[model samples]
Target: MGRKVCQQDHGQSRQNSNGHSNDHLFSTHVQAVIVQLSRPVLRPGFRPDARLWRGGIEGNFEVTISMYDASVGLFVPYLRNLSALLDKGVAYAEARKFNPAVLLGMRMAPDMYDLAQQIGEACRHATVAAALLADREPVALPVLEHDMAGLQARIATSIEFIESLPRAEINAAAERNVFFRLKNGTELPFTGRTLLLTFSVPQFFFHVTTAYDLLRHAGVELVKKDYLGRR
Candidate 1:
């Protein structure tokens, strides 16, 4: 039953006899738990205490991924990978007996942001997207330094902030409209889903890829696995 529901890519929910739609309860990444609710029928906003399970109905439930699973789930893992890439940078610089700051200041183009700024921007995109979805204020980032500790701290702070958001709030914000403000006072608008899928996720990856490219160009000895991270 769980395997069949998990294989459904449409993510559509089935209406129960009591007219409750278990939309939010199902997730593609199903845990190995079976729960049966018999007394009271499923209703709207009714969530099981478990994180996300794939059992209950005899065979009617459909598995669907949540908004939080799509957005924050993607950000947190890649952010950790970014931090590990920085660690490799520090190690490479130490072995070469040169200042790691040189690598941080490296950029692919003269007109582009340097490595430190690239890291900062990546962190910003992730945190900002998570905050907007969760309906909370993003953490005020300090000026980033072109040093190993400063770069690592920025990544750590970003990971902490995004991980601290309430999952339910982010899930509820799926269709909410969000505004992205630029430095020149231009505000771009997007619905929560569009914000993650189009704007923020792409922006985050661009900065992170730029940072990795800068480090690699400076001889940091990173492999493809370093960027993809461990499963």
Candidate 2:
């Protein structure tokens, strides 16, 4: 005899259901992790100087590229996260509502990394504008394109325009609902929930992991213990 609806084998169905649930859970975890580590305070024993962290290894070190490379890897993923939020029209309240306590289950650095955090936020904003104008998904772009002088000029102009506006004006832009229209005239609406679930969450974690890996490879005193912030 066939099993009843409720008793019918739900293993496959359950797995699919769980997959979606896990995606949201993971996204929440990422944001929570970011919030905890992006704080203003530094973690115990973290040296600001790269060489100090390297201990006795003396050979080659280029400050600019070294730092920039790490920062770039760390920043891009966070940027995608932010852009995903913006593209989906997530309210500031919702976006900023992340609480560190909920993320206790996850392993993350105890001290906030300010430079990484700030750059990540900036990337988010920049990517949001780029995505909107290009009529592409927010996570579609990697680092903002460095094409030509004209492109650079336009970005500068946009920044200046936004900066010149009153606080109200900026807020209005942030809140004003609009659809992303492609050059072909198709309109795409921003769906915050969808973006968070699908792209932002995964991309953000990927970048964070990459940054962590780069730091570790560079001889930073980071081990699995450091990621967990455990003694």
Candidate 3:
């Protein structure tokens, strides 16, 4: 008798003339095959459901990489720019024989956080976001970076912590549950991806941008590129 072919939805399986399963046969013949027949089958961690993305699957690990990109590539660099701007501001203050601390308290409005607090909060958001998503231990708590040097140090510490985190550890956190506390002591729950996009990223940008605005308002020689860290 001739060989027979059998197929299943979204995949194919074959049987030989002797009725043996083709799994080993096909594996030997083909170096690689992607059987998207089920959910949670991909490597680099669990597979995503094809149904979740209109027949496309984005594994949790990949999403974590995206978060890392945004957090590190964008967030940390902006903070570096802020630090450079602060250096310029300090020089200007000293040249005029003025107290640099006056600029630390400067804010767009009296009700909002001052520049020092904004820098601290910005660093807090960056480091905390990395920790929360990676399920890693926090390196530092939020502090009042009330001076340019202090704020710069805080930002540098955040960068170091973020850089030290392993990519696999962050991606593995997909299965872990994360939580954040709000101003009124309310703890909001989150999944790794959810926490990164919905909360951490937004909070990070808000504080960073506020710090930039405070500097701009105080007449620091800053351009859009300075705030964006493109230069």
Candidate 4:
């Protein structure tokens, strides 16, 4: 995996009428995997399918790590990136094509098992990035495999870890480079402008949508509800 990049950049902060920073609503790292992962799979010929290029699968997997790193290192920067790509002016189809710089070497494949392995690797990266962003020394990626059961287990574990972080930790900082210490004692840095517009938005949805594409191509009997996962 590539070295984690910081997402923080300076920008104006949005605030609610009550004078509290609205950043928490957007900046705090939400465990969006299930919500993102649950999106209905798209097949070839779909509107945004062009985003799934030769390296689409691998690129998507790499973004998960990027998101984790962004969240821990610079929460606001990640949110800003996410907000820009997800903005109404940006067509969802066009947004789908966005890829972060950090995912340069990830590879895509045609087989289901290989696809599963890619997702597993992405999940592992997410785990490490999350810990590192929290300022702890990096830990080994959890054991994962390509089987459906293994994927489910890994996803469950990742979600639980994400949920455990303090909600305040998700809010945007006044300045960039606010660092968090992870359990292993490493510092992870963050920023606002970069957080919102750069790494966070593009990397996250890219993999999620690609994962859906892979499953759909393989003929998973997926529907909108399946994508939403009972939320």
Best by lDDT: 1
Better of 2 and 4 by lDDT: 4
lDDT of each: 0.80, 0.35, 0.68, 0.41
lDDT ranking, high to low: 1, 3, 4, 2
Number of clashes in every candidate structure? 0, 2, 0, 31
Relative to the true structure, candidate 3 reaches a TM of 0.68
List candidate 2 stretches off by more than 4 Å.
1-190, 225-231
Best by TM-score: 1
TM-score of candidate 1 on Cα atoms, chains taken together: 0.76
**Which lDDT tens digits does candidate 2 get at residues 1-231?**
444222322123223211332123323544465555445456787534433323222222221212112222233334333333222222322355743222211223546433234224344444443343233355432343322222233334433332332322222232334464444898656543333334434554554454445344433344554333333
Residue 229's lDDT within candidate 3 is 71
Tell me the TM-score of each prediction against the true structure: 0.76, 0.24, 0.68, 0.41
List, residue by residue over 5-88, the lDDT tens digit for candidate 3: 221332444443334433433333332223344446548876654354422322221211344555555566777786877787
After TM-score superposition, what is the CA distance of residue 48 in candidate 3 from its true location, in Å?
A: 24
By TM-score: ranked, best first: 1, 3, 4, 2
> Which regions of candidate 1 fall more than 4 Å away from where they truly are?
1-62
Runs of candidate 3 exceeding 4 Å displacement? 1-65
- Higher TM-score: candidate 1 or 3? 1
Lowest lDDT 10-residue stretch of candidate 3: 55-64
